[model samples]
Target: MEEKSFLDRMLGHLRETCKYYTGYPKYLGPSRVIHFTSEREFVQLLHQGYPVVVAFTIRGNYTKHLDRVLEEAAAEFYPHVKVLRVECPKYPGFCITRQRKEYPFIEIFHSPEQAANQGRVADPNITKYSVKVLPFNYDQSAYGFREFFKRHGIRSSPDPK
Candidate 1:
């Protein structure tokens, strides 16, 4: 009886150790859509010299549809474009400051020279970078996003090595 109890305790300890090591997966696979969680991350992404598509959304059917569309777009345009989703309900202050009155609004921020030179390295020390914010007015679809990128001269794919 003492040996059985001791074995049970060891198993329990091993289970807890395994649980601690394997908490939760950050992502399932190679997810291109980045969920916005902090201001520092936002700033770092913007300064990475890639066009960023920021979707401001709340919890609803629209958000669900937009999330799928954004994920598809991000996958198709990986490395060239970065997609970010901001849950308005979770960050009400950010949405309010942005004057977001509707759900699933998207804005694209890109450097002025990004269209001409997509490989340009952005200055790290510069607090203020020249960026163009273009409001997305097209339909919420992968094709629409492609058209938007094409219309704005934003590269949809990374350059071939």
Candidate 2:
């Protein structure tokens, strides 16, 4: 049997990880379409007043569990923010490759990397974005992500008036 193409792999991964929504609540302001499979969609999300948080995870041949979590959060908030879970291949290069100067990550496109390259600037504090390196089969992060964001004063939706 032939192997799946990279685009097919990415699209499949996206289908398993994200939930597409048509609109968001009015209080949340506006809904920004999130495209996890394409970099262009990510850039659009950034420009549309929505902050994109990419949660890196791994799943064996499929990604339904991650998608369920992201969908649940999206439904609760709708438009204030967007969350994407990226599936990283299980390989040693995953640790060695630096998308940006200081951030060695498996994700191909990292905003901080772009910023770092355009200007000779780097964030000295690395713990700000430190994520645990989980095994290929371990689904959970070392930190409860929703709680971590809450602790950091990041809200799922805008406060009620």
Candidate 3:
């Protein structure tokens, strides 16, 4: 296989292992949203130690995939931050909540990773927020998350790195 492809596989396997240890809902609290679709990237960022805010349209009419993402995030991290899985699909507009707004999409981000994913279209016309999006998947800004924290802040625990 190509070098990049091999790297991808390696990363995927590593992610799987990380997921196993990230702690699922059975071990978490209400502050975290399990299966946060828009937070897949965000959770990874958290593991890397970035503060972030994750928002999603949890209304029944919305996609189920998003729900799964929330579940995953909740299982992974809870009580550490605020996870808002909004049940309202449609916002102020008559337009369905699925509608994607323009750039600088207003959101609360505890970490730089979640802030970076803002307004980027990860899947299609649908912005990352519309789909079950992990914060990092929407944008690569979180790619530098590790260094960002190291330079400006300190994590109390022993960093696996």
User: Which candidate leads the pack in lDDT?
Assistant: 1
For all candidates, the clash counts are 0, 0, 35
Cα RMSD of all models vs. native, in order, equals: 11.5, 14.5, 15.5
lDDT of 2: 0.44
Q: Lowest-lDDT window of 10 residues in candidate 1?
A: 19-28
Q: List the global CA lDDT of all models.
A: 0.77, 0.44, 0.41
Report the error of model 3 at residue 58, Å: 6.1
Candidate 3: residue 21 lDDT (0-100): 39
Off by over 4 Å in 3: 1-18, 21-52, 58-62, 90-99, 102-108, 111-136, 139-161
Could you tell which candidate, 1 or 2, scores higher by lDDT? 1
Q: Write the per-residue lDDT of candidate 3 for residues 2-36, one digit (tens) a residue.
A: 45688878866675665343343232334355333
- All candidates: TM-score: 0.69, 0.42, 0.32
Segments of candidate 1 deviating more than 4 angstroms:
1-29, 112-126
The predicted structure with the larger TM-score, 1 or 3, is 1
User: For candidate 1, lDDT tens digit of each residue in 1-161?
Assistant: 34568887886667545422244322323678998898778878987888899999878876777776787678767878999999888978777877767777999988744244335458755343457889999977778888988899988786679
Candidate 3 local distance difference test against the native: 0.41
Q: Write the candidate numbers in order of decreasing TM-score.
A: 1, 2, 3
